[model samples]
Target: MEADLEHYLEPGVGLLQDNASGCAWKNAAGKKISCAARETEALVSDLMVDQPLLWLLVSFSVGILLGKRLFRGN
Candidate 1:
């Protein structure tokens, strides 16, 4: 799962520059509030809906790993 770092680019150095503003849920001058958890849930749900097959395969792999770990002594 580890990725090679030799070919990594410095972020915001080329055409893919990042915006100066932070996530919309952050407060720059007032009391801090966040919807990060809800936003993350929505993002994951969107990904699952968009790629059902990928999610299915990932879930199957996780289930197999858990089963092996839990029943390894049997």
Candidate 2:
């Protein structure tokens, strides 16, 4: 019985060994765990939120530029 179980499990064992080096596992929701992009986005968002005037000016300028480009094709 034990030998039969080991034999049956050998393929799974080999697959796990082959994929052991990298991030081959998923979370409970089937998503690969990662934080670098999230961290950078959060940091930039926080900076934007903290600088209200700068954020507003930047957004206004971008909006104007986009509007002009769309309307005037320039």
Candidate 3:
């Protein structure tokens, strides 16, 4: 499924090779940090768990309002 999505999303771009294996951990300087994929997924899960629905709604509303104001010139 991921292969199909990648093909449609990046038509000109090359597909992700099946030879790919483990994930690389990059640091602030783009250096390998020795982090694992499981650790990254856990961190992302923790962040999503902490975020509130109201915050997302407010952010989306503000983005749309600002975009309209900027483009509509009023």
Candidate 4:
């Protein structure tokens, strides 16, 4: 699934490949940090556990905005 997604994405569009068994982490500014990615994903998943609807809306909005810019024609 990850490979399929990467194939469609343009180069340098924020894909991170974990070099180890653990997932990679990133800072608040979206910069990759030295933390485990699964840990961060778990933390975030826990934080939004009570707001699944809100999370869906926000994710959808952000995806639309990002898709517009990333797939826009030159």
Better of 2 and 3 by TM-score: 2
lDDT of 3 by residue, 1-74 (tens): 87667756655344334424423442332432334666788877876788767568888999999999889954
Top lDDT hit: 2
- Angstrom error of the Cα, residue 30, model 3: value is 43
- Return the TM-score for each candidate structure: 0.46, 0.46, 0.29, 0.36
**Candidate 4, residue 57: how far the Cα is off, in Å:** 0.6
Worst 10 residues of 1 by lDDT: 25-34
**Local error of candidate 1 at 21, Å?**
27
| Clashes within 3 Å, all models in order | 0, 0, 0, 2
What is the RMSD of candidate 3?
16.0
Prediction 2 global C-alpha lDDT: 0.73
| Model 4 C-alpha lDDT per residue in residues 1-74, reported as the tens digit of each score | 87778778776554344434334442342444435676798888886997788889999999999999999999
Worst 10 residues of 4 by lDDT: 20-29
For candidate 4, give the lDDT of residue 54. Answer: 88
| lDDT of every model, 2 decimals | 0.68, 0.73, 0.64, 0.71
- List model 1 lDDT by residue over 1-74, tens digit each: 11464247564543333444554444543333236666788999998889899999999999999999999996
Q: After superposition, how far is residue 50 of candidate 1 from its true place, in Å?
A: 0.2
lDDT of 2 by residue, 1-74 (tens): 65666766756686766578554344432442356667788989998889889888999999999988889943
In candidate 2, which residue pairs get closer than 3 Å at backbone N, Cα or C atoms, i.e. clash? none
